[model samples]
Target: MLIFIILALIITILVIKKSKTKLQKTLNETVSNLNKTIREKDDIISELSKYQDIIDVQSKCDELLSNAQNEAELIKKRYETLLTFAQIEAEKIKEKSLSAKKQMDEQIKIRKVEYDNILSTALEQSKQIISDANIKAEEIAGDAYKALNNHKELEQKAKAMKNVIEGYGNKYIIPTHGILDELADDFGYAEAGIELKKSRQKSKFMVENGLAAKCDYVENNRKTTAINFVTDAFNGKVDTILSTVKSTNYGVLKQKITDSYILVNNLGEAFRNAVITPEYLQARLDELKWAVAAFELKEKEKEEQRLIKEQIREEERARRDYEKAIKEAAKEEEMLKKLMAKAQLQLQEANDQQKAEYESKLIDLQKKLQEAEEKNQRALSMAQQTKSGHVYIISNVGSFGEDVYKIGMTRRLDPLDRVKELGDASVPFTFDVHSMIFSDDAPKLETELHKIFNKNQVNKVNPKKEFFKVNIKDVKSQIEKMGIQSKWTMLAEAKEYRESLAIENEMKSSEEFAS
Candidate 1:
């Protein structure tokens, strides 16, 4: 039994040792698995912290965006309010300006009416005064001439007695009275008569030689001397003849001498009344019937020319309107072409209503373009067929300042007609024609002239508006270079315009005085 116990104990000892070795192996494997699991838990905790940081940053960004949106809305509202206020202020200012302009225009109209009334009154007064003076002067001259004729007839009879005494070949006899005087009557009746005759002859000569203007003063003095001499001789002769009537039968001569004395006194009065007159150079413009008729004809021609110019202006206006229409049509056509292309592209992706609207617009544009093309053709034909005429270079310093000239062409029978038309109401003064060149190719010549003055052209776009600001010398040089023969009217006879200005100034002065 003891031996069996020892063998069992040994077997138990072996079993115990094997069991301890197995337990050690299991403990090592469990420790390794625990370390790996702890490392994985640390990695997951780090990833979760990173996600929490991301969430915090997103919340701050959203808060900043919300604040910015609120600020932007505040700024937009302020800007709109400010814009509205500015517009209201602008409207108030515009209203005030318009009101002020209206008030000023009304004042100007009142002043103009007052000025017109003053001018009319002054003109009427001046005309009446001039007419009265002329009429009075003529009447005085007529009375003086009638008195002088009566004096002449009486003096002739008084001199007959002297002639009979001198018929006995006593040419040297000097007579102060009807009888001869040796010492006293050196400047006697015959000498006085000769002087009077010479004065009459001189007056006649002056009129014949176109020097009547000079004869007035000379004739006045001569008439005075003649009257004095005849009166003195008649008084002396009456005394001598009356005393010697019984001794020599010269009583009839005394009566004749008395009549001559009275007549001579009347002649002296007549001569004193006579006035020196100016030479009637030709006749007054109004009195010359033919001249008045010619002026009327010129005025009628001007009216005709003005009508022609109006027609031309109408045609030009029509042409410009047509050109504008054509340009608009072309623009519309191009826009339609683009729209049609866009519509076709959009039609592929567009809804039904949008496609139909685009199609309608395209069809309408096509119809409008066709109509525009037809109108353009008509306008182009009319413009092309417009008649070209003489090219005129003209100047009006009063209308356009010096060195500003109008270089234009006209298709009229008379180029002067065009010049007159330009010088009408449109311009304050008449334009003096510097040159009028009539040519079959007037348009070409005009174009050439415009090109020469391209740098100095006043209106650049329209070659038809051929106004140039250049020295006349340069224009003349260019004209010469073109080998065109033209006349230059250097003198500007703006008579009517100048007179009108003078009248205007006079009226202005009168207005000032009245005010």
Candidate 2:
């Protein structure tokens, strides 16, 4: 029984030991679970703290939102109040404007009626004034017409008197109605020479015959002295008249001749016989006519000489120009040849880049050479062909006035040089070129232009004066009709002339202001 009891105790101890081990494991698991639960609780607490902070922030936001809402409400109310006041003020302004408009309308209606009355009265007054003015104008016009007629009659009488004075003491005598007319009818230097010789002989015969003068003195010496005195007086009068004869003074001299003849006849009458009888007077008149004709012939000869000299000078200038052109062309040709030779030499030994450059240079040089050759040929041809030249149309308004232009031709290589020479110090301003036309026959072109405008020549007495009073358009039309293409400067700049006028006007204005 004891052994059984011992085994039972040992079994009991083992059962107790097993229960203790199981308990220790259960305790360890429970402690681990507790620690885990504690950690979870701490995490929960941390989450709760975060949630608390969020809730606080949400609460703060709610509070701010509530405040904003309240402020917005307050602002809404304030704006509403202001809008009400604005509406009231606007209504008041609208009412005021309507009242003012009504008042303005009433005033405008009244003013319109008044204006209509004034306009009606003005229209009636204007019509009456116009009618009265028309009547006054008609009456004044009648007076003016009568006055004009009287003035015209007076002018005609004055003109008749002037004609009488200009007629050399004979109102019925025209310029070609006396001894001058007779001489012109059959006149020659040889015939005049013979007539002058006969005149001298007749004068000598009259003086010897005592027909030229008579004296009361019985003494031969006294009578001869008186006769000589009368003869000398008549001769002196003829000499005085003849001395005054000239191209410009022919008319005045003729009148002087008539007066001298009358005076001499009166002097002869004082000596008891007329010294200058009709026959003697005829002789003196013949001498005077011959003198006048000789003077005119000399003047004409001088003019012709001057024109010849001018032509010679022009020819000389043209020759010099031809020589110069030839020389210039030859020089230019030589220069181009030298350049072409240099370029060809360079091309012979040049690399690709340099060769291209030299070849291009040679091409240009060849073109230049061709141009130079052509120039040389042209210069030669021009030298050979004397007629080839430029015809220029130019104008100088400051010197010659408007509508006056010089149509001329020049054989110079540069035509403008001739034009420039013409516009030198001889004229107040430079000439404006209207057209410069190159022609194979420049002289023919110039002559044709001159012929077309011959009637419009400015200096009609001198054909050498190539100025014509013709419109520029007429010249251009004629040139076009000749089938010549030309550039025309229709409007003359007249720069210096216009500037001079402006300066003169400015000076006048300044003087006027100063005064």
Candidate 3:
């Protein structure tokens, strides 16, 4: 940009210089030619004067020449001054051009530097932006790959599972001290439940497979394992496991077992005893595996006992706090606090009472268990009197018409005794007692059999009694409701009917006294 301006100024100076030179040359040529032409003309005028009135003519010619020379001189002086002014103006123009040219060059240099800086900055930013984009893209791709890998891992795990997905944590296939029944329920089907129970039994309280194999008691343990838990039991060191299931070396696990006593705490004792109970099928249980369950149960029981004591202390403190609150109530305006305290005391007392009731219920349950034990003992003793024969089913329970029958399981437990315990009297003897059709889970079998048999369908034993089934639990629930009536007093007519005219005599006596 500055170069173009400088070129324009130089061109203007050259044009002005050339025009001044041409004007000067033309003026000089014109002046010289005029002087020569005047000289010749002057000679001619002088000669003509000499011919006629020569003297007079020559004098006039000389005067005229003098006048012309004076005019020419004045013109020359004016031209010279004009020429000088022109030269001075040209010099001024040149000086202005040189100053403008210098300024233009400086601006050009500054603009070039700025443009280069801008270009360099833009290049640097572009490189940085590209680098950042590439890094971010790579990170995203890596994350996507990781996600895909995780998904594949999950898919593989799912494929590896033989049956039910153990979405619930599978620390152990079936832990020791844990009930097999609970695990079975989680698996969602009866057969699976049976397998879960079988797993629990195999583990006993849970031990390494090799350790379990060492014991004669667990020789027939049917559980197959992805990881063995019985190897520690063989070495007699189940508490500190530092070795694998297949290895015979008693390292970490052995150390742990030796250091950790099995039967020190109440929970430990409970679980140890549970592993040996016949109900859990201890005879067939892998004692080595049961150790794991025992450990867990012991921990849980310890926590439960600790919480129970804490709650008891809290309740006692609350009760004591309330008892003292009445004394503070005197000479006080805030009856509300006292009232609230009293209410709190009552609530605490009630809670204590509820806890007592629960404990009582536990006692009752214990008593019931004892009774059950006695009954079982009696039944065992009466095994001699027991006979495999037909039993009667002649009665039904409740008004919500359903097939609730009196099912007698052989002749071991008297039908009358069973009926009475069920809170009902047995019906009068009717028809013949039929032959035993089938026997499985008797309670469940009975309910299903009755559902199939339908109403007035006595002595009619169906072949598909085994296949046709009802939930015994549901039947038992219904039966339970029938045997007890919470609102017996609400039925006015039934109440009156049961008592007959006992109210009439009392009414008559009150009326007579009034008269």
Candidate 1's C-alpha lDDT? 0.63
* Candidate 3 lDDT over residue span 146-210, tens digit each: 56656854454443342124322332233222343344333333444344366655555434333
Tell me, by lDDT, which candidate is best.
Answer: 2
Q: Worst 10-residue stretch by lDDT in candidate 1?
A: 280-289
Candidate 2, run of 10 with poorest lDDT: 170-179
All candidates: TM-score: 0.25, 0.58, 0.18
- Candidate 3: C-alpha RMSD to true structure equals 42.6
Task: Give the deviation of candidate 1 from the true structure as CA RMSD.
Answer: 37.4
Residue 398 CA displacement from its true place in model 2, Å: 0.7
> Alpha carbon lDDT of residue 82, candidate 1?
99
Clashes of 2: 1
Question: Candidate 1, 14: how far from true, in Å?
Answer: 99
As a whole number from 0 to 100, the lDDT of residue 33 in candidate 2 is 100
User: Per-residue CA lDDT of candidate 2, range 1-515, in tens?
Assistant: 99999999999999999999999999999999999999999999987886787889999999999999999999999999999999999999999999999999999999999999999999999999988876787688977755665695456445545544665444333342244446564465566567667777777788788776666667888778777876688688667667766633555565555556555544555655535556666666667666666565456468878977976787678778878878887898899899988889889988887998998899998898888778878877887887889999999998888989999998887789999999999789999999999999998999999999999998855667899999999999999999999999998888999999999999999999999
